[model samples]
Target: MVIELYTYPVGFIFTFFSILSLFRLKISLTIKFGIVGNILYCLSILTSIPMMYYFTRDTPLLLLLLSRISLLIINLIYLHKLRLKKREITLEDESEIRKTILNLGTKFMRLEVREISEKCGFDRDSIIGVLKKMIINEEIYADFFQTTNTVSFDQQTNIDEIDRLMTVYKDWEKDHYEKET
Candidate 1:
């Protein structure tokens, strides 16, 4: 009885952490498997109630074994997904702000909106407008240097900025290229 109660909570804790780790790691397979495994493990753990009621005794070993097996299967599937080929980003799919921020980060060692516009040959006003939207969306942190009129973005900021830019750029490029060709 004591063992069954203890193992139940421990299993729950492991399942919870596994789910959180999957999200933090950004591993899509891990996230999927973890969610499925946690659900199964939770059901198996709940079965302990029936097991005790029917046998009038503890069933720790059975519950522990089932939880472990579910976790093991999830891990295997996650590893398999990692071994698959990764997709590449195409120029037509690239975001303007994201690409511009990345280039500026590399060349100037800083991701300033103004510098990104100049480096990427994009209009300053347009870039600022896009950046404002990103900031509102919580995609980027637009830190204004009031004295210098400069805005800087961190690594995640660069990624967000680029993602937004690419989305807009794709639409514009589609029309422009269609017109030219």
Candidate 2:
């Protein structure tokens, strides 16, 4: 197969411009138009391939235009779904953290601290301090393996002890709030 020197490079230039337009366009309508423009520009690359195959054939310009239009429509729908999925996952993560905090009676799990911070929008240092205090007070017991830097909480913590710990946390939150006001 013979290679055309200009075909791929021209296609690549159009592709780069299309990507820039997709990011730079602000208004939704303008963005949609930009996406369509990008698709049409990319479709030109595909036409170049067919142009090589049938050197003498008159390629239908309308067909290339239609293909680009269809591709743009498909991509818009896909982006909408992706945005919805991201929102749903965020809600689910928040719900999960709330449930875990309630059931565990304190946000002191070594393994889950990072996730808790993300879910609750807390700083890492604050989470570490809370966990450290819980460990120091014997409110929760965690076994740390120094060699592996791994820690696991005791699964057999008594319900009564957890209830008492949660009550203390609730009282502390009330006092903290009052102080802030």
Candidate 3:
């Protein structure tokens, strides 16, 4: 009965993992899912091999082998695509942040996360999450202080200013991470 379901399981599992990997929140789950799914697929094929002798026909055996190989190839392609992908922001997220930043303006150097949340019509935690990513990736001159629950922003619009601040931030992040280990 289990052997009968082999054909559907691998394709479904690979697809599930590949789709799961598209979302950033479940990245670890996707990696584990892919690894486990592929291993299970391989094991299923190995076990299925002995059944080849039970069948009298070459065509069924050939069909089964072809299907297995096809599924493997498809999954390998999906994994490759997943590897090339970076976490992406939707248009709504980008525009929302843009509006939030515009609201923050070029003058204000700092504000509380709750303030930004109320002004931007976004949740406080998500605002912090997006700002943290912006600080790391876009070199946005912002710092999220968890203790005070405040976001400190540098009003300096100059590229050189941002670069220097980002360098300092990277050092701080490195030290922080090092201490955690």
The reply for model 3, stretches above 4 Å from the true place, is 1-90, 158-181
Q: Largest TM-score belongs to which candidate? A: 3
Q: In angstroms, give how far residue 80 of model 1 lies from its true place.
A: 58
RMSD of each: 14.7, 13.3, 15.0
Q: Provide the TM-score for each candidate, comma-separated.
A: 0.28, 0.30, 0.36
Q: Which 10 consecutive positions of candidate 3 have the poorest summed lDDT?
A: 81-90
Candidate 1 local lDDT, 1-181, one digit each (tens)? 5555565566566667667777688566455546555655555556566666477666675666567667767766766665442222234423766556545553443445566666666555556655555557765555645456466656565666668899899999999999999
Ranking by lDDT: 3, 1, 2
Instruction: Write candidate 3's Cα lDDT for 1-181 as tens digits.
Output: 4854774577567758757675756654565566566556556655666666567534665666667567667756666665445334467965797667645745478888777777777655566667787778754667779898887776675345656778999999999999999
Total colliding residue pairs, candidate 2: 0
- The worst-scoring run of ten residues by lDDT in candidate 1 lies at 85-94
Q: In candidate 2, which residue ranges exceed 4 Å CA deviation?
A: 1-11, 14-59, 90-92, 95-181
Give the per-residue lDDT of model 2 (tens digit) for 105-162: 4444445555656666644444444545556767556654444434467655635577
lDDT of 2 at 31: 44
| Candidate 2 Cα lDDT to native | 0.56
Better of 2 and 3 by lDDT: 3
* 128 Cα displacement, candidate 2 (Å): 26
